[model samples]
Target: MMKGFSPTKYILKSFKSGKEFKDEGWTLDAPGEMEPSLIRAIYDKKQIDVKDDSWGLYKFADWLPIGRVLEGSSAPVTYKSEGLAKELGLENLWITFSGYWPEKGTNMSTCSFKETEAYSVCGRMTPEMDKVLVVASAGNTSRAFAKVCSENNIPLLICVPEDNIGALWFEEPINDCVKLICSKSGSDYFDAIHLSNIVAGMEGFVAEGGAKNVARRDGMATTTLSAVTTIGRIPDYYFQAIGSGTGAIAAWEANLRLIEDGRFGSNKMKLMISQNLPFKPIHDAWKADSRHMLPLDDDLARKQVEEIIAKVLSNRKPPYPIAGGLYDALKDAGGDVLLASNEHAHDAARMFLELEGNDIHPASAIATATLIDAAKSGLVKKDDLIMLNITGGGEEKFKTENELFYLKPEIVFDINPGEDEVIERVAKLF
Candidate 1:
């Protein structure tokens, strides 16, 4: 068993009820099959004090829920952006990047922030799981989890839309323990999700629990953890473009942990989350001052998904309204959703490349553009500390030096499949 690690406690983030179960691996009690409410791990940051020198994200082992992380794990890299700050007329702009920008030491070769969650999610798993983990993602997430599980020889079955399979590329061939399942009839991330749920019901497979997984939320929380450690205090406004808003929630969770640590200051950082236009579900909901999503309001949002520049920002159903999820995070942080046009994101990407000499993912460009708007609208002042999570970037640079190995799906299926046929195909791999 992995040693030198033990949870301080696991509690319902809403109820704060986990002091009753005083050990690791306790199942959180919940009603109905929705896995109940999300659970969070609480740690004594001082007693479990994280040594700053530990490489990558492991430096924050004091707060990470997982006992073990993959070897050579990477963390979100943060830096004070002089050029972009000057361009946007903001004096205190910090960039937290997670991708293959080597000079920044960002080694997440998937070129996505999803790797943060991947390492943490896989880290929490062990051989004793005895079941293959089934994950559904649009692109970046599937690629991130596949890369991490492959490196560690952990069993994973990834379900992704057929078109998004191209994004599931790695520098090396995938491990034999990992399997990719393509959803042929699936048109979007939601379709892929529908298919994966069916596959997860089989005898030897387990759903990775999309948004509800504590490991993922805590893992991505490291970006926030890294920012506070470097800035020496939480920023005034935290920014990121999110599909599921899970990253923003992770940031909020990490903020609570830092406050509890009693060393990272007490003020809450405001969240300025963004979404690309033509498909802004969360943005529309927040605009209407609603906690629960009003899909009828953004009916055109679904019709316009293909037109959006940032396809990854097209999560039709995010974990926003759930208890302890995005809505709670935004409310806790005094946050609002930022909306951007294709022109907005494109302009930001151009400015970033010209000024910073680095390319940002479209989703990240949306965030960058929103930050500029926030500054111009006087919502944020010149010297307010701001942390912009460039959730993913450096793809153009990464491709210049590396060869990508794209894996073909071992099985192609639809939302409803013959159970025996799916099982037979998967059993052969195990």
Candidate 2:
């Protein structure tokens, strides 16, 4: 049995405080919810050890701030993609794939890395808060939470945009506790978030903290742990595509932990996070060397979000520029943001499918495309060890092999809905 398998304390990054804490309730460290903050797990290293192949994500349970492991191989699968390496002409290339590809044993039914956050956050909840867990997503995040909630018989409420309803698919029958509320066509991801927040305030509902959740952040850090344990060392560069940029922050935090663990080489890994063109607020902010994002004209941002192929990367208000947020993560890792256009994403997706024999999510394609740009621009040397986080993939094969049971919306509302009846309608789901 793994000793010290559960985290002992929660450290608030912004406050520079490391206090022993419990797993229940909201884990973010700010005095008030309005002041944004992030927290992490601090383990008892004397009893903790990340054993190799230790039954999925539980391998890093010592660091994950959850009560129990969800019954599945929830950790990301990491491997050195030789064919992709040879094609990209980089001598050392690792791919951390997080999606359904049973042949390789990476079975994320939602087909996105969002499931990592879902597992940890769901497990972190206190039984006292028997109220339903509420999550807002464009598609992947909500679908991930819904499937997991159904599997575990945990009550959950998913608020999502209507157009992306086609994205929510489950091989098994959904449980009654999983209720989906989708907004109309013009209602984008932010609309879904707005609605979810309103519901969160009402009785019998608890908000699933977005980037602020400690379990969610540490859960994502497993990707880095998976890579380090597999490769026996950290890579020179880390690549990923971000919406809320939480994953990149997770990677940086994981790197820091690994450095403290003294197993992986102590050198800092450079983050090469990317975004889809025309709608890249975080990317634009990084380019200007500014902590804050370029002022967003909501209408313009929405239009750009529509134009981008990677709809999952269209989070309007990301965690960037906040204290101990994405900006700090990038600064700590000596990282920079890269831009990938639609053409780049399309070409890269084709290249990945041909080379790796698996279909990747559009956001993952954008990350691969960013790698291509880096290789072409001489930003990365041919022999540099690189880790490409194929954040989501295997859609084509997954769809062909399994039956997709699309989840129907329990309630559909108009754009930016503000009726008191909406809250009453959601309350009835419990």
Candidate 3:
């Protein structure tokens, strides 16, 4: 269990009851079976709360509190991936990156796109909420949320894989509001998730559901919004690599908003979701055209995907086929699915570095590989408005400023454990 200082405020709301955001708004409805209307309704009804002054990092210069770009990034356009353009055979391909690399811009807070999601989520947290307890099963999201919470002094408790602590690279050390906890030995992200849920259910803690949280969905969705706004139109096709598939879902929601905004584009954009090799259940299931997927349920499949070494993109059980699953989202968008092996991802990253002169994280490399494959297969046109969401990059950006970061699993749980230890830990926090 993880304990942290109490926060002075707490904010809660749903997608439906937001403060009447009306800039060419689009309805972010999940598929009929996987409808997010309940959350959206909450947001619409003002159930979800945010500070009146809260504004996300993605807001244009006109909206930023400082009225200046972050230190490293000069403009959003430079962050977009360029190597992907030539390979895709598209004249106008764009890759929007967020980080502290001088070539683009330094999201000096580190963890790249994860910061994008965290900042947006925090911005929406009204002062009414004393604190926010975010359950991050992975290092990226954990570091991201921790960074934001530290900066804002928002009490945040992060639950992550025991093995992932001490391993993450960060823009800086976390603040007092941020606390990291891991499960016992043999525990993974899922186990921490279960434990985090129990604690959140207790008094004064709000659980930031990983993929299910609308703030995360909307926050990640801003990549697309930035794209269309920068280019003045929605690309004919949008693509990204997925771990939990939330970013893709966020893109879908953003597209809907763009359509509603009307100035960017009135039509829906086709989505192309990519999976790294071996654990590509979503890709395989989509190719099979099966509405439902039978679990691979084999360690071998997991290992095979792990060999690709793009560990961040590995989500054994992606939300697919169950209403808001990957399959349903792609099908509704008239999109396609792509799978890339580790070899492919690495090669693409190498080629991109040479062509575009920028280093990209391995997970995002998977998307670049898919773009190349799609072009070679002639699946996309040369002139299509193709936008590749380079979710992260600039591994070397902070090496000069600080040392590398790492994750060290704190506890070792065989499986589920008795509640006594967890309860005791929680009690100590107050």
Candidate 4:
């Protein structure tokens, strides 16, 4: 039997590589990077300091370890989608699948990495203050956080685009303890983000500042840590779908810590990040080899991306231009970026299911497409260790529940409506 949980080793000790920066906030001290630090600070018995207390919350979870593959295997390795890799020339790769439909018999729950983030973020919260935690999601994140908050009885105010509310798993409503807010016109994820900031300005509520939250970053970083621990080292490359590119950033951070532990692999992992086609500003920028990208003015392009086969990976303003952004991470890591069309994503998904017999999420298929492109272009070596992050899957599980997750239509307003009118509508929620 396994021994009692060890928080020290899993969290406190592992965060030793943490550092703080003025502009970039707290970050891990990744090797060969120009950023300040990965971790802000650490808190332990008998002492507390400013650097460590930069963020209000300071707890961590010993999340589940990296899953193992089935050689002669037992228990059918949950989240291990074998067919997905072979279809993309990743025969000897590991799929760090998150989101819905874990092989462990859990149906597609909230359908996001938010579950992983919430488990770790909430583990850091305390009962001293009634934290009205605010989170914005296109769909999956709100659901994931709502489920975690409901089970933990954590007060939460979730914000999402009205049009995207239809994407939420309506079968599981936000817990009664959690309040929901929908942006006007069902704008995009950015609209919900703006709404979240407005809500955060209110009393008793705090915004879980997307990628800025250390808990959120580290929580997602667990994916990389799990992969390293399980595979016993960092791979030659890391591929994942990104909205904010936070997961990629997390992997960069975690790899640094693993290096410090001196037991994991080198700090030489390549980052291969991808965006959905039609509206991929980041991919376009990466391809152009430019530091910045102009926002797409093409309505058709935006529509195609918004209505993409893999809508979850779409982001209007990813953190690609900021300091220590996706571009920098990839450049420093000697990485490559790619864009996958809806057809490519769809075909990849189908191919993966047929070959590996695992139904991968559409976003994951985009990453799978990139892997194929890498193989054909000779960007990947035959024997190089690779880790493909299956961001989300298990859409079929939603059908079994026989119900749709929907949100109540809240107030609707213009894109940047009058602040007074917005404040009044928000005041009603409290």
Candidate 5:
């Protein structure tokens, strides 16, 4: 552990039962049978003080549930927007960027905000813990975690859909401590998750816990912290594109923390989260005002997932309906789910490049598309304080400056492989 960094700075609290416990490697459940809920990090510090001496996201270490700061990490960049704000006719618009833009001092090498989760989750691991950490992702997330664990020499096993294997490209060769696996071709994010769950059950491997991990959520929450700290107040509206809606929920959680801090004004920002059209499960559920997601046909869901341009936003089983999840966050934060068509998203991507001078991920494009609609339709007033979260960007720029190396899967499995076969095969990789 790093000097002066306390593992006891925060306690894990159940969002449903309000029970608190100490960090015990990978604890995702409460003491007994109860309603399903996310466990949260309740930090000891009520007012967050940015650490000037710390690097990257560690500057916000007061709230992040990390024992040690990792090298090569960077904080999200927040700046008052001049170009996109002018184009949208909004007066108080702030943009928080989470990807590579060395000019702005943002350096997430994977070109995705998922780096935030990777850094914190990996940081939470102690040297005493020798278990292999398992992660399941569609694309961007696997890339981020792979990059971080490879650099840090942390043992990691990554499972991603074979269709998204293209996203595994990196600037440098990955270390052998990190291993890659994939679900069969034509599989979706959920299939990748299924494979990961099977691996996590085996001995010597541990699940990364997805949205259930407080460290992951608190890491992603730094975007909101960056925005609010930079803007000096919480914006009236917060916009982002969601895959699992984890980041949006992170924003809402950060909003609650800021309100408690008593420095930033006590106002909850409306989370105007968007999903790509034809694959908007969260949007569909929100529209129907249902806590539980409406039944979606498996074949139709897989087909819809393939149709969306923003492939990273294709989580079939998002944490929307669970306690202390997206549904509850949306209700508390006063927001509505929005959808963005492929045409509009592409146009928005082009507009951002032309106006903002940066290439963004397709998911970020979908978020910008929704913001444009909201501005034009008077959902936001001309002077309303707004923060648009550019979840990922600068991939084109990064690629131009660096040679790319794609990671190859050591093992591949069908969507629903036999558990014993999986365990036997995956165990050999180590």
Candidate 6:
């Protein structure tokens, strides 16, 4: 452990078998899994004490499964909404803003909530571990990880789709310890994941276990922690746009913890999650009330991804069907999946800027559009307290404030490169 923190502060519990185990460096699953399940961090502290604002995201370190607190981190800023709430005629709408809005005291430099994952996942690392971490992303995640790893001097290898490379722009040149590799043009997030999986298996490389990592999920759970602590209680509904649906699952997990704390009321917030239209696998699966996703052809999936405005939400293999995943979270929380079209998402983005004073990501816009529809359709009552998680925003403002330097990929590989060829080329980068 890193000096002051204790590993015993939390235990990894298997979601399916109810088995608990200590953290063994990078434990993603239970020792002997009877069924596929998500491993969650069961923190020892039942009542969470928020640290000083100087701690940034570490304010909730009592709950996060991290060995050390990362510097320059910022927690989600949750406040009662005025502009959008009044426009929709809602009396108690709370917005949890997670990007670079200085006026709102939000400071996620990457302009994405993926920073929560990056900081906690990387913070879980110790000096004794000597392996390069491998991460895969559609865009936002890679940028967040790259920025964190670069600043912290942690060796990292990022695999992202070539089409989304523009999202890698940073305020300064990244450190040499962080190297990027791209899945060539026409590939999607799944292709990037495939390439990273092969590379992660190679010697001296460790996979940054995406949604499976307890640190990541617990880190994302901070969004809920921030909202509940700020709102003084759990909201009636929670809304967000998802690619992997991991954020919604994290929120559900946080709700359970807060309920156990005995301070927050024992109310399960309905998870009102949305997906951008045409590339809505989770939405389709949830709407059908199926634990398994309907078979989607590779070509058809890729075509749908191409048709969507929110490229970051183009995840082909989201953690929806697994035990203790999105499906279970939705069933327990009681909510429906909604869809937003590209045009409506664009309109919502503009409206958010005009009303909220900050531009949002495409995925966030989809979420806003869905919430608007819900309010207009009477799915949500006027006086009900609702939490709309603006997962990312303020990119346009950040761009105008800082000169960005884009990180160039160390190597670009075909969508499906041979394992030997990849191992050989990637090994040489170090």
True-structure RMSD for candidate 3: 7.1
lDDT of 5 at 374: 99
Cα misplacement distance, residue 229 of candidate 6 (Å): 0.2
TM-score of each: 0.91, 0.94, 0.79, 0.80, 0.98, 0.98
- Candidate 3 residue 57 Cα shift, in angstroms, is 1.7
Q: What are the Cα lDDT values of the candidates?
A: 0.79, 0.82, 0.62, 0.63, 0.92, 0.92
Q: Which runs in model 3 stand beyond 4 Å of their true positions?
A: 1-38, 41-84, 106-108, 184-187, 290-293, 298-308, 321-325, 404-412
- Write the residue-wise lDDT of candidate 5 on 1-430 in tens digits: 4566665388888888888987776677765747899988888999998866347888899998877878888999999888999999999999999999989889899999999999999988887889999999999999999999999999999999999999999999999999999999989999999999999999999999999988899999999999999999999999999999999999999999999999999899999999999998889889999999989988899999999999999998999999999999999999999999999999999999998889999999999999999999999999999999999999999999999999999998988899999999998999
Cα-based lDDT at residue 65, candidate 3: 14
- Give the clashing pairs for model 5: none
- What does the lDDT read for residue 327 in candidate 4? 69
Summarize candidate 2's per-residue lDDT along 31-70 as a digit string, tens digits: 5345555666666562336655545666777777766566
The 10-residue segment of model 4 with minimum total lDDT is 67-76
Q: What's the number of clashes in each of the models?
A: 0, 0, 54, 15, 0, 0
Expressed as tens digits, the lDDT of each residue in 280-333 for candidate 3 is 767777888996776676556535643656666656556565455466568778
Model 4 over residues 8-69: C-alpha lDDT tens digits? Answer: 22222222234323322212244344543233223222111111111111112333211111
Clash count (model 6, backbone only): 0
Better candidate number, 4 or 5, judged by TM-score: 5
Is candidate 2 or 6 superior in lDDT?
6
Pick the winner on lDDT between candidates 1 and 3. Answer: 1
Candidate 6 residue lDDT tens string, 291-318:
9988899999999999999998888899
Ranking by lDDT: 5, 6, 2, 1, 4, 3
Question: After superposition, which runs of candidate 2 have C-alpha atoms over 4 Å from their true positions?
Answer: 1-24, 32-35, 46-48, 51-54
